[model samples]
Target chain A: MAEERTPLYRRLSRRHLFRLPLLHSRNGKRRWPIRSAGINFALGYGVLFLISATLFLSFIWWSSTNLLNDHVRAFIETDAQELRHRWGHGGAPALSEAINDRLEQNIDDDALYLLIDRHGRRMAGNLPGWPVAVKKMNHFYELTIRRYTFTTPAQFKAYTLPHGFKLIVGHDIRGRTLLSTVITRTLIWCAVMISLLAVGGALVVRDLFRRMVGSIARTASAVANGDLNHRIALTGSETDLVAETVNTMLDRINRLMEGVRQVSNAIAHDLRTPITRARNQLEEAFFSATSPDELRTAVDRAIGDLDHITGIFEALLRIAQIEAGARRSAFTTVNLNQLLSNMAELYEASAEDAGLSLALDVTPLPSLFGDERMLQQALANLLDNAIKFSPPNSMLTLSAHPVMAGTAPGSGAEKKPQGLEISVRDQGPGMNDADILRAHERFFRAESARNTPGSGLGLSLVQAVTSLHHGRLTLTQANPGLKVTLFLPLLPEAERTGRSTTPAETTP
Target chain B: MRILLVEDDPTVRSFVLKGLKEAGHNVDQADNGKDGLYLAIGEKYDIIILDRMLPGGIDGLNILETLRGQKNNTPVLLLSALSDVDDRVDGLRAGGDDYVTKPFAFSELLARVEALGRRGHNESAPETSLTVGDLTLDLLSREVRRDGQKIDLQPREFRLLEFLVRHAGQVVTRTMLLEKVWDYHFDPQTNVIDVHVSRLRQKVDKPFETAIIHTVRNAGYILRPTQD
Candidate 1:
């Protein structure tokens, strides 16, 4: 009963568990019973397209059929009205003659005519009898009837004339039926075409997205497994931009990873020498000391070596702290003039003791917003490098000046570099071009400077601190020596283009 | 001086206890925070060396806060492996007198503990002028005069001499001087402090017949008063 109650299309395609294509016996490929992404997309688009096409065809079906039926009914009514007028003017014989004249002309090929007399006898019309279906119909009625010229369903309307005489009129409905058949065929063809197109489009789209996302996921997994060089391959499409952005992020990660590895390796490599030397000194002092004084001196030297090792660790910790950016919360406006003056004063006496001339040239600068302690450390490292490397009687110059964004000295096209330029130049044996490139890298000491009694983490710490303060560190050759410049960004300009964005602002 | 050491680590506790005892201070030890809180509240000590991460219900901060709540104004030095500046700030803000990160030299810890101890006991007298064996520092005038001969000293040198003279005969390490005199908590990675102290030494004791400032070997400076 329920199967009969359901519509024809729904009953034909009703989902059944037994009919599901879980296992394809022909190929044994075992296709999934559930709809794939392509099928889902196809169904979604096809149903939408078919619904609209059906609606359009349905409108044409209604208008064409209704026009044909209305035309036939109106024609028959006019003929009957004319016949009644003829009957009143010239009695029954004139009316009968007019009917025979209309039948003889037969303008419409599918037209029908039937006239029944008062005693239900045939009159002057072509039909042998009236249809029994519309007998109870009041004055006008329409129904399909058997006709000699039309094999399909026919439409006819009958009207009662004066004195109970009935006149029936109709036309063959094959044209209206053919018109509906043409509309329904067009609708079915359009639906089939739309379904095929939707399926094809869905397959193409699914494959495209799958390929793009697959490559990225594969690269991501490869990278997670410690293949640092892995990168997503671009397909030269709009998604390439997304791939490019991911590649940029990957590059940064790779660089940071290399930095971390370099730092750890440096910690192991650079520290081992001092540790071995200190151990050797202690052993030698213990085994073959001539006097208490010599032993004591050896022990003191060992202690000194141990202290240097501790100092390296301390510097590493401090750099880690700066890189972690814990000191940024303490940013306050600091007067650079006063700070530099005091620092110059602090280092002046030492330079003098070393027989080096210290020149301080500071230009006016706006108050900076940063941690004073960290900035002081960065400046201290630069000045310390200058002093330590400069020969006696050499002049070491330290200067500060503001540089606007468009006015990067030496080149006018530099962009967004507006900040205070603080430089320390030393007239000593300067680094070569190659050394200057990696000067700020951790534990990156020049080959010739290996014998120098210093940890190479100084400039690394300086760079870390400068970056924490939203500043930059630049190392350049000063002809005869090295020129290290620190760029501390001015406050207002940093806030303009949304730099210095804190976590609170980003999250909310 | 008396100190209460609340450290769960046996090795660190023994090391610190030995250093404090060798430095001529009495010490009490507790392995956990609850016992530490009890000892701290029940008795008076010159200073408390509390470990920040204690293995008990009451951590170092909680104990310190509880003590402060009970109106205990005893000085505390929180020791921790947390070297971050924020952690230090939090430790100090929780009523700790000082914060010293771990892997510290015994000399540094000893110096800070002695400084805190001196601060606590010296709160009563509040001396205006400090004198060490005729090395007189006029706090009001900011002058250092040795043996009736006025020593012209730079302002930084004056502050250094003043600190030494105030903490006379106590072992004042380079770290302490860097923190107390230079206001720099970071290690300078050089003997910059030693150089400044040497410069200060020349002006203060070079011409004197009896040298006031003495370098304690492998430790720090001590201004021993000379008895004629």
Candidate 2:
């Protein structure tokens, strides 16, 4: 309906420019195809070419006529002088005889001569009074005359001569004029006909190209508006590279969307269990508790269950925040040593309470650029997992050292540039190949560690935070347990040494 | 003794009602804030139990706020499912004399009610001590005597005994214990309340020849003169 309401030009402009059509689109839009640009250019050129051709041909015709007339005038003047010379030497008889002899030799036509002794009469030529006898200096004039010849009938001109003699000459130019007219008319007709044909051909191509591109555009619009299932119909013969590129991009986007859907589902499914459990526990206590002691016990159990639920929720929220890619703008120069040391202190008691030996081997480190809270959370989760999964009393070692200055592969780009490498090693059951690969999958629990109580969101959170920091997290087995190492680029020494305590901004 | 309960959940209301009934107190239930407020204003309840979340334009917090606004000194025990410390702080700040979380055991509910009831009575009766039967208490001196012998008590135990005695024959709810004696502030959702109550009971009741504090099965406790 909207398409019908909007003129065609509007739709075209909008599709081309990715915006609403401007005011000029109110007219019933012209269905200009993509080939319209070329078609318009060709049509305009052809029309101008035809107009110029007509003018050129007409000029040529006029110029040819003028040139022939000039030649005739020159010949008459010379011939008349010769006639006077003849008349002066031998009187009128000689001139008449000469004129008659010249006429008899002109069997080809377009030739004429006359001799009149100062009288309005022709003497020695086909019957024709002097044509265009307007006054001239020396009694000379030029004019077209209709006359009859001994053999042919045609138009001729009489050039009156001096001393009682006139010379009339004629030669047939009508046949030549007819042939030139045919040639000029044929050339003009060919030019105009070709131009009209070119315009017709261009319109056809414009309409064809419009349909082809419009179909693809419609499909793309549908996809942009969230109909991921829509695919461009590879219509027309021109669909080669464009169709291939669009299809590939759509395939990748669909895959990414699927992954997001799966993660969302996992969060919903796993978090509900603990929340329901806590609710049920509370309900039971409210109904059956007999004394203050029983009531307090019930409330305690419910609170504990709620704590677990909150834990999962908090972790999920943190991961989501990291994934939103906003933390990049909040990056600041952070002291890795101080950040790690703070975490080490915070988790030491927790680790001690869990009967795990936790150690922080901090090598004096340069500053790094990142969100402090996110880094702390990521590191804390890693350490928490190590402490939780490892057997009680196992030694867990944490170390941070600079990536050797020039150890990067072939590129000297980041050579010897100070970046910190942090690793956490545990002495409990180590992860095998399968576990290591899928550890970052949300809600994925290791087969050997299923009995333990956890939501399996830790590694995923760690991965998200690491990505936010523009860092890499590698998981490997430490011979006896799991080892997770993180590499984060370091800020220059000046920024790191400037200030120690600043909260990271969340705006980005 | 009489008690007033204000809670929105039907399940929780019925369970708490049954427990208090078994504890031998006349129990009144109000589903939401308006009805609860009407009840609190019209009736003289030994203790008023309030739920933080309620329907009908009045929540536990609102009821407490209104009650305090009206200068009604009836002790209110606020109940909720939220156990966060911030929530507790807000509830208490809103004039809730005591606060408790949901999924509470009946016993803890009764203990809190009794404590609030006793605290309310003590405010009324500012005299240092009050005695019934052979048990005598000196509030000013913080002393207790049973059969003419001085009996020492922990602060929590003294507070518990004081609540039981104040409402000597009434049933208290577990929500009561959470709010009053422990001043739990937030629901720990742990058995810490029960553990503390048991220790108090062992000290206050177990050593006595005539137990003044009697557990009422699913209901709370009753402090009465020796039956003999």
Candidate number achieving the greatest DockQ relative to the actual structure: 1
Residue A210 lDDT, candidate 1, scale 0-100: 80
DockQ of 1: 0.24
DockQ (Cα-based) for each candidate: 0.24, 0.03
Compared with the true structure, what per-residue lDDT tens digits does model 2 show for residues A307-412? Answer: 6776676566556555655445556677788778755654565566667878877767767777765676677778778877878888999888777566842224
Error of 1 at A467 (Å): 6.9
* lDDT of candidate 2 over B1-228, digit per residue (tens): 689998888988899999888877798998878899899988888788888888887788888888889888787788888654457668889877777665565666776666666667656535678787778888888888877888888665788777666667666654455445543222222233444555656666678776776667655556677755
Q: In CAPRI terms, where does candidate 2 land?
A: incorrect
Give the per-residue lDDT digits (tens) of candidate 1, residues B1-228: 889999999999999999899978999999999999999999999899999999978889988999999989999999998877678889989899998888777887887888888888767766677887777888888877888889999888888888888788788998788778877666664456677777888898789887788887777898778887
Error of 2 at A40 (Å): 5.5
